[model samples]
Target: MIKFLLIVNRQGQLRLRKYFEEKVVTHGEQREIIRQCLSAVDKQNFLVEFKDFTVVYKKYGNLYFIAGITSNENELAVLELMHHMVETLDKYFDRVSEIDILYSLDRVHMVIDEMVVNGYILETSQPRILVPLQLLDVARK
Candidate 1:
């Protein structure tokens, strides 16, 4: 199961964080991890093994979309999920960017929730994930 997800920018600033399990971590610890992630030389290395968890990340433009999971989890599946998430966002916002995400954080959060429920991955279908968002958008009008 996935533990947490973190989206950070090129400057090592965290853009979004979602914790599936209850884990109390200090700001300093998170900052240290961000520092290491930002300083990584091999951008192609998608999996980074930490002490307690493994991180799977993909660099998208200036943002790094990451998933933190246990050692026993499926690395490839998580990586695919991350890519699917980016593609879903791109379709929703006509090419997603940091500015677009910041402007429509609610939509992003909704999409995330649709894709993952209680830390477990749901469906990979774009239409399945966007159903809620589409319904909400229709209702708002």
Candidate 2:
């Protein structure tokens, strides 16, 4: 199972976070975990295994899209899901950036909700994820 999803910038600050499971640590500890994870990787894609969970992350532009999952979960699958999430965000925002995600936080969360439920991947197709968001955008106008 997945533990959490996080979007952190190069500055080591979190842009967005979603937790699927129970809290196993305090806010500070969580921050520490993120910090450690970020520090551990220098590449665009990586999987870091911790004591209790594993981190799968991919870098996009200036932000790091990271997901935490149980050790038993498929790392490659989680990584692909993370890429899909980014692509969905890209489609929604035209061009994805930290500022775009910040401004469209609610919409971004909507995409996240559509893609992941209870830490499991709900959809993989871009069109499946984009249709609802497009409808929502049209309705908002």
Query: How many steric overlaps are in each model, in order?
Result: 0, 0
Clashing pairs in 2: none
lDDT of 2 by residue, 10-70 (tens): 8888899888888755688678767876787466548776657787888778888888888
Task: Report lDDT (Cα) of residue 133, candidate 1.
Answer: 86
lDDT minimum window of 10 residues, candidate 2: 36-45
lDDT of 1 by residue, 36-114 (tens): 7777899677877776888788888999887888888899999888999999999988899998878788898888898
Top candidate (lDDT): 1
What is the C-alpha local distance difference test score of each model? 0.85, 0.83
Q: If candidate 2 were superposed on the true structure by all CA atoms, what would the RMSD be?
A: 1.6
lDDT of 1 at 2: 91
For every model shown, what is its TM-score relative to the native structure? Answer: 0.93, 0.91
Give the TM-score comparing model 1 with the true structure, all chains together. Answer: 0.93
At residue 63, what lDDT does model 2 achieve? 87
lDDT of 2 at 46: 88
lDDT of 1 at 114: 86
Each prediction's RMSD over C-alphas, in Å, is: 1.2, 1.6
